[model samples]
Target: MTEEARPESPDIPAAEFEDSDLLRPIVESGVGFRVTSSLLLLVLLTGWVIFGRQLLYGLGVTGLNQPVAWGFYIVNFVFFIGISHAGTLISAILRLSQAEWRRPITRMAEVITVVVLAIGAFHPVLDLGRPDRALNIFTAGRLQSPLLWDVSSISAYFMASTVYLYIPMIPDIAILRDRGVWPHWFYTFLAWGWEGTPRQHAVLERAVSILMVLVIPIAVSVHTVISYIFAMTLQPGWHSTIFGPYFVVGAIFSGIAALMMVMIVLRRVFHLERYLKQVHFDYLSRLLLIMSLLWFYFTFSEYLTAFFGNEPSEMRVFFYKVSGPYAPFFWAMVVTNFLIPVLILSFRRTRTIPGIFIASLSVVIGMWLERLNIVVPSLANPRLPLPTGYYIPGLVEWVMFAGGIATFILGFVIFARFFPLISVWEIEEGRRLSVAETTERLEGYLPDPLPSAPGQPVSEGG
Candidate 1:
């Protein structure tokens, strides 16, 4: 293709190309962006200040005590990490499947993975009270410990997912470079001299293909390793064989919901109706619905196994979640993660943007609750006959939680300010090429025209 016909070509007039909308967030700034980013920054700063207090005062400042050692930090750690799965896994799956509709959604999905993963990775440090102690996991860490497994798996995941997120962005970075977007040197460096040549496109495509395949297992294993932190223990409610798949399902379920919410908000804020249409919402909501049902299945199987076994140690922890102080959170998780999502997403009428937003929000809340229920109740009801433990997050923990959230939002805000949240080049490729590709694929699904009826007149029947 000529330079003029290249998808990333700067010679193409902005008026003619629909993808200029994707560039608006990067090139143009307005009052709302400033206000929103400022608020998020304030929250992030407050969170850091509270974290500083924790550093000075130590774990004594938090609700953690006795048996219930982990609190909001670990819970949020699991929850945020689970949310991180929303990006790379889904984007990789869609890309691997060659889903044409994935073009507009994958960029934002990948962003969620990298940012949320970073935040989630920090939670372990926060849990350590003294951040410096985390170094022990590297210097004095044991291979047998699940904690070490967590560090290794999460670190690998962060690296792989970051590279996965950056590789496909090179073309768009090159476009910004050609258009003389600000920070020219930055884009020029990241672009690596991308000129949209056939060889360059082939190399980029091959690298992306390899990363997508590799990322799926890494994403799955990240959550499975997280689950191992609990399952490898002999503690009540934690010693279970099914926790691996269960955690993975929960991760993807929560991840999809999180991704959906991000898409809806960005779609509205950026006025991207042309790119993120109703069909995108419909398709993603359906995936969310499927995940909801799967999540319920895993949840039910887990609880049912414990209930049927009637193991005394497990029953105590189980009852604590079902009827004790955590009951509210447990049932609320059921309602939000399963009932609300299923009900809202089941019907076409309720699967609209507003409805999906509500469902997605509920799932996000419910998944966090699920993490809380999983972590707290088990610890509160120890297998030993020790006194029952309790936890209520201190102000510092709450602030830190808020900070984690603010950091997530701020990451996206900062990213939007610097780069197109939507993948311009991919969207252009889909518009130019996917239709014919899809048509051919669909035609392949049909019988081969019954061998053309032995070439009897070679009928081109309507």
Candidate 2:
């Protein structure tokens, strides 16, 4: 074996470290974990209590009136779904690009996609409050409605993302199974007889590659269809050809921000400093910055087109956004979504972990407001002009919203307790194979050394 074949870089974490360290979370999370988890679960239960109240009192418990039938629930539906885009979409893109750094981050991203997606999927049903009737769409399902398209697409995405999240996790689960972790039977079942043989490894890689290619379009379509829920309508502000791309971009933008926040929290909580290094943060921050710019451009083009068109209905909604009751929310959205992120993430001096967290927090809040603005204004200031109705989400909606967020956190906590947030096998694989693979690929790019200048110098070490 050549001397160079040995893994040399000190910074390259050892595969054995996976056994010693990464498995710790699965084996034992400290007492603080229990306390915090109990708290999150308690908070999550409160939302159910509020939901029960809504059931008792009826939809009147919400602020939904004639014109503004949507409220915090629908806005949060869009917001949470947007956050869902961060996971599988980014992870798939990075993996397809053959990015080595993606190994540590992809699992978390995919998990976020899966967990938040499940949470988001229930939002529309929550809005309806009749989970039983949600199935009527299937019983009396009409292919004509855009709402039907949303149901089909989101359901497909959820199933696809869950499978994607699971496929890569099998090897790790097998490792835990072999180690005889407490839930040996569960991991044993999940591992699916994976012995990490050469054939198994190859099959795993092929499956991941195919899924990565497929997931990007599915992720994009999920948010695009969600946008169609509004865009398909002939409402004043909601109707636009750009809404599809706009929603897709906004989804990814918010998704990246949400991922950053998750990354930060997981790193701090799990003490994963070795796995999730500062370089990961820097790479992810660059993505966050790019998405921020794209979001700003979309928002600009959207409003600019409206301002120039000056249609009475569009203008009423647009002007209301700029200077009416919603003005504060609109400008705040701009500042949080664009200004704060741009200012913090643009410069390395302030792009610390905390900085990214603050920026991510801003983007999350801003994106919620952005969704609210998109949903409310056009409905409140209807083109038909039947006494503009304003929406203020009542106590029930606020409790439910808090519960939804708590559910996300609690889900992550529960997931971490059960599994390693990082893809330990993928990291080891990269350390082992990526060097040789990258060198071979780079060699293919060189022009065969120019035939040694026609043999003028056939020097041995030239």
Candidate 3:
């Protein structure tokens, strides 16, 4: 029988435990990596060309016009930022809850949040017609402007998430240092002279714990402030007290879906079936299902309020979503976001890898549609219709979208090549923790170890 088929025994070396699950996937995702990297580079070069054109010729190259100022770029901005929320939520929230399974997964989720947040945060600058005047937002920055709120909250969230990703990474960096494969100076620089001493470990643990506790609210606030940017405007479809929670929930919903997709791709690419087991997929599927329901509830409430209140601006935007040019996208969002995920994830068999993959893919696409719906239709149906605004995305927008996604892939690809994508130290830590947690749970279930044969005096400890 294969090693996997053999029953696990105590004889298994503890050293074998270290983050092998994470390494397995990285090892397996082979040569095609170079191809993906090359493609990403080409895309990045193209994006630069487009960006240069925009910079030189101005925002005139894009379909963006007056009133409908924000278009695909902002949609993607919100979409990507929402995706960033998932990593910290998974890594920090689950870590705080003492979920033993979090060890192998937290690193990937945390990296996703940091990288995607970087991409998302840059988008507003891209949206600015006068990016050269960008510092003016800060120099003459109005504390009252929702735009300024976005700049502040996004910057804070980025800093917090980056620190969160770096803290746990120190141990792994120490591992790499020990491996002795480096530019000497480069690894030395990043390793921060880590010795992994007991004091160092203790300090690192304390830092991570504090950051995890701190990041949740910051993550929530970042998205809330993002929603406030829209809601603070009295514009149709943008104004709603519920917008804050709605954006946060939607951010998490999309973030989790994006996380599932990343995990799936990495698993397939890296061949980490052992570490990223079916159990992880199953749990993720259930979470996705829950988020789907939550999203549906929020979407329903938001729309129902708009429909029933008969407010002209809100109703105009709502009907435009349902029956206007955006009708197909809106309904498609319903099907993909709600119907598909709910049906597939609800079934046990459908919680498997392929099923969850379908659900996650659908959710990602649907969430993008939702962002587009929120942005465009409202702009299209202005309070004072200037010939019913039309947003025809030009080449610049497409290049930017492609660049953002390419950058995401590029970052992961580079990470996979340089360092083990999985947290080696954490995985080992997890196995020990998992066994301990399981034993504790099982002890609770079992009859007390027969209070040691009267005065036979059971050895106090196992």
The Cα local distance difference test for each model comes to 0.91, 0.87, 0.84
User: What TM-score, over all chains together, does every model reach?
Assistant: 0.95, 0.94, 0.90
Where's the lowest-lDDT run of ten residues in candidate 1? Answer: 7-16
Error of 1 at 172 (Å): 0.7
Q: Taking the tens digit of each residue's C-alpha lDDT, what string does model 2 give over 14-74?
A: 3455435877877777897899899988988888888888877778989898889888889
lDDT of 1: 0.91
**Better candidate number, 1 or 3, judged by TM-score:** 1
lDDT of 3 at 405: 94
TM-score of 2: 0.94
In order of TM-score, best first, we have 1, 2, 3
Selected candidate, larger TM-score, 1 vs 2: 1
Model 3: worst 10 consecutive residues (lDDT sum) = 5-14
lDDT (Cα, tens digit) per residue for candidate 1, span 168-208 = 99988888887788899998999998877777887999999
Error of 2 at 216 (Å): 1.2
lDDT of 1 at 242: 96
Which candidate leads in lDDT? 1
In candidate 2, which residue pairs clash? none
